[model samples]
Target: MRGGKALKHYVVDAYSTIEQNRLYYLRSHQENLWSELYYGLTDDFNRVDVTGDNVGHVVLPSSYTGSPRYMKQLYLDAMVVVHHHGSPDLFITFTCNS
Candidate 1:
């Protein structure tokens, strides 16, 4: 369970709103770190997207992949898996309700 609520639900809209707000709180708490993140980085941003990099920096968890604030979570996850598992040869996706 997350934030006292189950992840999957029929009420997607409510769940998404709650989750978004929760993440907003999390990210907002990190607002003070923005300047520190960009302090010595660079005036010339390297990312191709303007909208995403405007916020400076907010480290995202791996589970936030494909969401609005993806923020290199996929790259982070890939690096972790490669470091621990010695590179993957295959990937599989499946869904089930029990």
Candidate 2:
């Protein structure tokens, strides 16, 4: 939010087994610095699964959403974490059409 730029939008498409996908999201959002409300929401829905081609959109503050290097690092980190959680064959695609 400190960037003073407009929010950036992205579409994420993930293909994997339900359990694998669930684990991917769980690990991706496992950081402890999130607000209490966010923790509660994640805890409440920890068992949810995404079957087949799961697609969703997210709006991120500009300061945290740009730069290819940063995005690539995030993807790499996510893959590493998710790999440790379960399947090593998870596929994720991110698209920004804005």
Candidate 3:
């Protein structure tokens, strides 16, 4: 429903960002950044059943936690989710709890 549409939009936007920033976001040895973003979003979309009533939870792996660049990217991803789905009830793994 609405939530699914929202998630889809978010994924599309993430893909767009990766596509637009190919050189800047590339990893060491010239790896494409788009694959990671695409796989992550698609995997989560497939794993979770997002609905209007239930909240969609996106858990970033521990690897993405400390890096500033990754965090910035995550922030952008989150904005897309919020823009479409409204403020979620809770955000667990993304924040620093230290």
The sequence of per-residue lDDT tens digits that candidate 3 reaches over residues 27-87 is 3323333346444566666777778754533333324545555787789889998999999
Cα TM-score per model: 0.35, 0.24, 0.25
The TM-score of predicted model 1 comes to 0.35
Expressed as tens digits, the lDDT of each residue in 35-77 for candidate 2 is 5533344554455665553334222221243544358668888
Give the candidates in order of TM-score, highest first. 1, 3, 2
Q: Best candidate per TM-score, number?
A: 1
Per-residue lDDT of candidate 1, residues 1-98 (tens digit): 46344435546878789889967966887655345443324444553456854765664443564654355656777799899989678888999999
Task: Name the lDDT of candidate 2.
Answer: 0.50
How far off is residue 32 in model 1, in Å?
A: 3.3
Judging by TM-score, tell me the better candidate of 1 and 2.
1
Best-to-worst ranking by lDDT? 1, 3, 2
Q: Evaluate residue 76 in candidate 1 and report its C-alpha lDDT on the 0 to 100 scale.
A: 77
Structural RMSD, model 2:
19.0
Count of clashing residue pairs in every prediction: 0, 0, 0
Poorest stretch of ten by lDDT in candidate 2:
6-15
